[model samples]
Target: MTTTIIPNLQNFYNQSQQKQDNHFCDCTLQWRRGQLLVKPSGQVKQPYLPSLHNQPLLVECLKHSPVNLVSIDPKLGESSLRFWADACEQAHKPIFLRIPPGNKLPKQSSQSLRWLQRLIDWMIALVLLLIISPVMLILVMLIQSDSPESLFSCEWHVGQRGKLFRAIKFCTTKKYKLTPLGSWMCKYGVDNLPQLFNVLRGEMGLLGSRCWTLEDAVQLSLKEQRQLNNLPGITASWEVETQPKLLHLDSSTL
Candidate 1:
């Protein structure tokens, strides 16, 4: 496994909506894989995913991964700013005042808060999955009929707290080759629907940060790493914010 850091793009909910329930909505980090992909969005070499011989190996792999904490941007709100300052003072690691603070709870709140979040995510994922299943089936049949070799595929994405997970999505294209099936998948974003399962499994949220790829996350800075503290999401601030800018990042600077 390679050493990688999380990106810190923290910010908080608006000042008026301070309830713990609502704060997570904006604490989300920004992610944009299609935009930053070294190649057009398609099957990346399977080499990108970690190989594990056993369950313990998997746990050890994650344990070894450098942690990237989720943080709220100081520029976003006051509470976020205070929390970021506090963490900086306590950790005393870096001095990037040129400052932070999430879903990683303005620090880890009570069980009740956890329960509420789980329930909401579960309900929404269930509903969306149900509504999309038929269309999904049709799409799958079309994809398989069009190119039987590319019916299914898994994308390795960096999830909550920077753990790597395989997100299921349509194959879209044959290995190293683009087909008509791949074209539409990218055009309509239908390829992302399966992420709802990621949501139901508690690995992601519907409205959280843009899902991060391990390739992209590895390029993040200590300051940017704070972004991982929040739960990874399917739709995020990226939709509203400008495109993410990690394509040209130089890891040595960090």
Candidate 2:
């Protein structure tokens, strides 16, 4: 694979939360024969030759690789970004789309701190689940009686560092018609209760930026995309206080 040195966009998170000094985060990206390859910084480079076979090959060569994060060169085109974005999302790795020089890299916490935060998230979700078990059980029965559809609805949403995950919520509506019980549940935001499972799964937190669907995520401006650096929250200021007018309104609501 053709390898070249590029200025790494290291440890970027949302500005309001994290900060990191200038330091090389050991990561590598390779482009050869129209395919992308990611490797560790310390690995010895191997000679790459274009394959002679005519059969198609999967572009994701590192699907099982242990790379923690992947960074894309700012100069790469949209196709490359989309390919890596989907790949990284599947591998559950954060992706960094390098910004141009002179722009401040967003602040980020250390890896340990992030892990600590995740542990806390798990604890909080567990406690909440226990405390609300009775209410959730009653809601489940009501939802079953209200609609023939499944009890939960899940849709693809962008998570921290642009990773994509299915955000789960209670199925409050069927065919766009909110059930009588669903209307009451939504009015009190109880429809969001199922998302605590997403928190336990590490796909969301108790408080952070709103979770955006992939369609809306792709339409985001470069500056707005930075919000993906933070985990989507079960309850966030953006949902009620200061919403993004650009998002598809119907999709934002349960």
Candidate 3:
């Protein structure tokens, strides 16, 4: 029955209210000891919990949780919500006890446009791949002429919904050394050209949140991870474009 709360919850809640004009809402859970209580905020008293037989209530509860956008910690298994409840309790935030209406949720920016954009991106990628394949082959030969080994490199990346997929690119380095070519490719983003295949396959999009490796994703703050709820991974974003400036500033500050 130990309650651990996140001290930042109040600040986040207050900020949300100011930015959203009090439109920010979530399901409220109130529990003490072994008793579990659930309800939606801003609603009249109703028995939404203990009604596990009601599929709608369950869905509503999930839909309304403020932390829905945050990726669940795998180690928590199904008890993640319980942990959130404990955190809320420790923070001394008023425990809400009714599930919000399921239908009153905001739409994601990428889902509706995905299918239409997929075909267009695929056609563009196919054209690029055809044009680039020969050049890529030549580059591979050039690199191998210097040193013989694997021609391509694959790195696991995090995509939308926190899915992991392999991102492939031409090897720009020797076996042991990440070559100058690799660094150049990364600097100009030439290394990302092969990711067209991922876009064509619907594993990613032409424009959306930039994908990261699992380690990078895990390092992100809760607020940062919430951005992933909208779309699959992409080749670039504001974060990538401004990374250099950000790094410089961070270094100076440090």
Candidate 4:
């Protein structure tokens, strides 16, 4: 079976691999014909699943072999994004469709939850800094003695949404001047300590999406826009989930 990738769903039928579904049909007729196409807007189109089957059969197929995400543009107004979201839930699929009120965004669970999380992060980072202060101080001295550079440095990173922030870190050398201490700091993640201030200042969430760069975000695929759908965390989901999935998919596809 082959899947067609057309920016315009209305043209799916006309560019058929074979004439079996060459006739144009509206979404209503296509759904009635037990064919499912992951499209947001289309007046006339071919249903990807337009086999001689009923709704129940189509539902079963969807449940078994479903596409995980389909982002629909809310501006299209061809179909209710909510309706498709519900249908996807019933079929155990997930649609990243845009909802109404374009300005609406994903929010923290609650004000209390946000404050509590922040308090917890503050306490944890503070306590850790207190305990490790002596060691960090010694490391700073050693780093200064070993290298002719500052013990700390700041790098710019894209925070939540597209805001830029200076992420301070304890470092063994200045920019572009690597030292032996830098290697050890990298191995142990000790250089990441100053970002505790970022977590405290609410520039980033403790657990959210991955930190990105302004250039990196600009270069992302339209399909990858969902990565920015949520607030970026100091440690992010992309570092875990998307990275591994892409690796496996690339190897298998090759």
- Output the number of the lDDT-best candidate: 2
TM-score of each: 0.52, 0.57, 0.50, 0.47
Q: For candidate 1, write residues 183-246 as lDDT tens digits.
A: 5665556677787888888878877776665445545676786676567777762342112222
Error of 1 at 112 (Å): 2.8
**Clash list (residue pairs), candidate 3:** 28-96, 38-97, 39-97, 39-98, 39-99, 40-98, 40-99
**Model 1: lDDT of residue 250:** 20
lDDT of 2 by residue, 154-180 (tens): 866667766657677788777766666
Task: Please give, for residues 1-254, the per-residue lDDT of candidate 3 as tens digits.
Answer: 52211223332332113222222223334443433343333332222332123334444544444432222242222233333333443333322212212223445765466666777777878898899998777767766775467767776555555544567766655655556565555566665677788877776777777766544555566666665454454556324733563344344444
Ranking by lDDT: 2, 4, 1, 3
Alpha carbon deviation, residue 191, candidate 4 (Å): 1.1
Error of 1 at 131 (Å): 1.7
Candidate maximizing TM-score: 2
Q: 1 or 4: which has the higher TM-score?
A: 1
Alpha carbon lDDT of each predicted model: 0.50, 0.61, 0.50, 0.52
Candidate order by TM-score, highest to lowest?
Answer: 2, 1, 3, 4
C-alpha RMSD of each candidate structure in angstroms: 17.9, 12.0, 14.4, 16.8
Q: Which residue runs of candidate 1 sit more than 4 Å off their true CA positions?
A: 1-111, 237-254
Q: RMSD, model 1, all Cα superposed? A: 17.9
